[model samples]
Target: MGCTTSRYATGKKKPVPIREIVVFVPSTRVPKEIDLRRPLRGSLSEGLLERLAALRAKVVALSEKWSLNCSTPTGNIATED
Candidate 1:
């Protein structure tokens, strides 16, 4: 992604010819999901729903492991903020 040549130039002198370089990154249209239930229905889109479900499954698995590792008064844990 580059070009080079001899006889370079510097400031206060003739400017060196410039070559352009470009980098590319691949991206997908995958969207993020946020869970919402009754009493507070979420504006979840179809694509987002799938992503949310996958994320929820992960959290459940992690919570199970964490609960076993550290027992506390609250059987499960939650965050208010």
Candidate 2:
């Protein structure tokens, strides 16, 4: 008989150690081996407010689209007791 390669229609696997195992726990993680720098400009960041204001519409739209129920201390999202 000719030598046949391993693994056939019978779905048999050679005796080998299983390596694909992943365990995830909902626990906090700490940053490691990385560098983060501050803003390139000085303290008085120019045009930052305007840029954020421009994104407000998009953020609200996305929040409604995803049904996130996002609420903040703003007019449309916020409510007072």
Candidate 3:
């Protein structure tokens, strides 16, 4: 009998390479807290203000898109009073 080779592709031989990165932070450091309230004296820098506005817009958009009710607290999500 004669041997015939068919041109048919099989499963994926090489899978995607996933890298696990472990970051070890320093144990002790200066306590730096991010104050959410606006500056007492003057307005924040223009660049910072723009960034904060953009971030707020993104959050609102995401909440609307996923039908997430901000008032309803299901998990760790904060609810507005």
**Winner by lDDT:** 1
User: Candidate 3, TM-score vs. the true structure?
Assistant: 0.32
Candidate 2 per-residue C-alpha lDDT over 34-70 given as tens digits, one digit per residue, 9 for 90 to 100: 2122342355355764565456656656656444333
lDDT of 3: 0.49
lDDT of each: 0.53, 0.42, 0.49
Backbone clashes in model 2, listed as residue pairs:
none
Candidate 1 local accuracy as lDDT? 0.53
Kindly give the stretch of ten consecutive residues in candidate 2 with the minimal lDDT sum: 28-37
Better of 2 and 3 by lDDT: 3
Better of 1 and 2 by lDDT: 1
- Which candidate has the highest TM-score of all? 1
RMSD of candidate 1 to the truth, in angstroms, is: 18.5
- Model 1, which residues run further than 4 Å from truth? 1-42, 72-81
**Candidate 1 residue-wise lDDT, 1-81, digit = tens:** 545554446544565544443434333222344444432346656677667677877777766666555443344444344
